[model samples]
Target: MSQRILHHPVLGSLEERHSVQFEFNGSVYTAYEGETIAGALLAAGVRTLRVHEETGSPRGIYCNIGHCYECRVHVDGVPTVRACMTLVQEGMRVTAGSVLPTPLKKGGHAN
Candidate 1:
């Protein structure tokens, strides 16, 4: 028998696993129903989510609670989305753009 190596951490005892599909750099990735895109990305060893808007520096989740803006990415064709706070949905498409010195608001409510 053969097995595959695991990269992601085990989510604690979730009851149901809903299948959700999303794209990363034009590649497809799937996660459980309730998992965040950032969580799933980390599980799959995705370190860099977006590039710095100005400096073009690589960034990821500095704070899991959405305090830091390091893990910003574009979701569903929208730009400047905070990955730590954004929940994963079925067939969601995201784009990673360069970071900016000043953060911009999309929905007008700061996360």
Candidate 2:
């Protein structure tokens, strides 16, 4: 089942929109034009957007708006993109963010 809101209390019903194809982590998925990347992924039942940069813990959408960057992902070879703020485009490529290496001190110890 899709997670999309088909009917809104105030907006009534959903309007027909063009469908677009996008790739997420090597898997192809369909999204509606003008829809945010995070929205499409959520509708497709994708909860985990990325892993924590430091701890390698699963991170998903915390804020639908652009304030919280928990939904950050790689889009079109670009890194650290806010999926909630980015619109889904045809042929777009989205990848989950990976764990980043910790910074090292001059003494070769992790900072």
Candidate 3:
């Protein structure tokens, strides 16, 4: 049930490419070479890349062009890498962003 676009009206058919394996949240998934992380994940039916830091709501790709930070995910232990901008690589480790503890105020309440 891949959502890959095999043919585009203007771009025509997709070129043949090798497949690569990457880990996402401890699960291994296959992705086509030269494809973006976001693209591959979406093709695999993975919509929620991460959750909102504060609200704990689901978050996924918003702007495929990388303008919006909604598609941000951890790649190879690095934090805040935009999934739409980063290309998928073999053996790469990707993890969904998680909520971090909020900064506390003078007493003990979160800011």
Best by lDDT: 2
Q: How should the candidates be ordered by TM-score, best one leading?
A: 2, 3, 1
Q: Show the lowest summed lDDT stretch of 10 residues, model 1.
A: 1-10
The order by descending lDDT is 2, 3, 1
TM-score of 2: 0.89
Q: Tens digits of per-residue lDDT for model 3 on 47-99?
A: 99999986789999998998989998999989999999999999999999998
Give one clash count per candidate, in the order shown. Answer: 5, 0, 0
In model 3, the clashing pairs are none
Q: Which stretches of candidate 2 lie over 4 Å from their true place?
A: 105-111
State in Å the error of residue 38, model 2.
Answer: 0.4
Deviating ranges (above 4 Å) for candidate 1: 1-12, 99-111
* lDDT (10s digit) by residue, model 1, range 1-111: 112133336654445567788898898887767777888787777889988776787888889888887888989888878888888998899878764666655557665
lDDT, candidate 2, equals 0.94
TM-score of 3: 0.87
Task: Write down the TM-score of every candidate.
Answer: 0.74, 0.89, 0.87
lDDT of 3 at 59: 98
Tell me the whole-model lDDT of each prediction, alpha carbons only.
Answer: 0.77, 0.94, 0.92
